[model samples]
Target: MPGQVTLELDPSLFGEREKRVAHSGKLVATAFRYKSGVAGLRVDNGAGTVTLLPFQGQQVWDAVFFGRSLTMKSMFDEPQPTRDYLRTYGALFLHCGGTSMGNPGPTDTHPLHGELPNLPHTDAQLVFGEDEAGAYLDLTGIARDAKAFHHDFVSRPRVRIREGATSLDMAVDVENRAGKPLPFLYLAHINFRPVDGAVLIDSVRDDRADATVRQPHLAQDEDEAVVAYHRAIAADPSSHRTLKAGVPIQPELVQTMKAAGAADGWTHALQRHPNGSGDFVSWRPDDLPYAVRWLTRGPDQDALGLVLPATAAPDGLAAATANRQIVWVAPGAAYRTSFRFGALDPAAANGLEATIKTIRGG
Candidate 1:
């Protein structure tokens, strides 16, 4: 009833077909190839194509639809992270920040983002099977993050793309391997490129959370040529208040989800893609209550990234802990969460309201 709402879709054609996965020039199988230190795998599940980077933080480097990329890659020409670590950017990857994404908050000793991007997955697997969808393919990997005396954690990611479908799903499981309760942060650092003239539209189910706008106007900062544009958006008033972006609220009654676990309830958002379609990413609100938008619309770099995290703001470990926004994993325990990425045809309907109703189904 507020703002300009526009969305469209065809639910009936959301057809049921057997999915598939394969390697380059081959069907019903998978393989790994490398160029220098970079390694990647080609995945085609009948409908779309995905290139998975096994060595580059175990992320999907490309998700292609209709012979075009629906995902964004950083403008940093180089495909992999450099020796400097922080310069390692781009590709629709995971955890640009890390288990501790964001700025070196209060007790940060690592670089910006985190070490996850450069940390290679020591173990992995590729498998194909026939499920309810008839046929499917997925790649699973296990990576560990253990500091000498800090925190020891494990990440298990399984990426799945269905055959004849315009979508991909990533299911990640994180475990605290330390003896004492350890703090944790997780984000699906999704980046999209060529967003120079892209129109972005997102909705808040509750109310608009205070969004901390970065220096969006500055193409470059005094220190270094500004490399990116980003925004930290809260899912609820509680977390927004902690950023001092707004007034205070009853701490207990409010859903400071970033601080707590996403035990129940969920949140969703849709964006009119720069490629004439729509890209939608949704997650359990209790798991990733905060959303961050990184736009690379600068003179130096050109791209856009949407980071939905289990915690609020990739500011740092200290700020998250202080705001009670950290996802605390009990000693020797684990947690699991997932997010969905799919494309829709906004032109299916005549106008925005019809589009929204068609996709959401009224």
Candidate 2:
């Protein structure tokens, strides 16, 4: 069996350096806790470091590639308790939904973005292994959402990063333990900070007809200026490809896109920064048929959510049901999806851009 260690929260170990460095060409994982008592795990893969918050929905809290930060900016300074979702919502990768996601309907009782964000895991472990591909570190956790006589399900989420790599691979296997079939909604809320002059690239059609702007209900009371921005997006979805540093995407701009998959059945989304560097994510379109573009460029928070893969748009449970967009999982059945988030240097970015152009037939 591969070596494994159970995660524990220890404030005394906070900010301690990783004595077992990855200099030997092996992946390293260190567990620590923040001053707020939130548990975290840091994994070093020689080329980059990723912080995982096991106690807080197993979110990828922060990621740094070769001293460059690839995460979004937020008001929160550190991670907070699971109940304080919004207060500690500045993670690089956040897993949303499982049972229910998005804003709740007027009479609905579920919390915002479902019960996954900041939801504590029942148990988590760090497993070290060497495969044909390379040495890798795996962070696995089990979380559950249940209600009496209603629905019960377990989500097993795993995040893996290999040695000498700047990418993280994520997969979630959700099992329905309820007595009957259950409806499911899922979204990978990946938040990548925008770089000035970065151009957005994705596998979605660039035509306005292939996109639909769905204004978030929470932003309905915005001022006229923000409302006009939404109108601009509706009129020309292609405008979303250009990113500026100081623009305002207050509340957010939610656009549902008609995505196309490559010959290998994977969809690609990337932000090619002006310096020739970039951040990208790739996922299987078959598993997540719906692609959403979420951008929030407020004063305090600036994020370019390149591509959000989901079983359905974040239109609340009621709307999804009415539209028959929710995915149904049979009792004792499981649903699985995987994606990769990586940083690219100039050369790699150039090569990827070429490939994307070829795929787009440009």
lDDT of 2 by residue, 36-137 (tens): 778777787888889988767889999999688889999877788866557787889989987788767776677788877777787776666677778777
Report the error of model 2 at residue 81, Å: 0.5
Alpha-carbon local distance difference test for all models:
0.54, 0.80
- The TM-score measured for candidate 1 stands at 0.71
Q: What lDDT tens digits, residue by residue, belong to model 1 across residues 266-286?
A: 444445544556655656656
Off by over 4 Å in 2: 1-24, 216-228
| Model 1 CA deviation exceeding 4 Å by range | 1-34, 81-85, 96-99, 194-197, 205-209, 215-264, 273-276, 347-362
Model 2 quality (TM-score)? 0.91
Worst lDDT window (10 residues) for model 1? 245-254
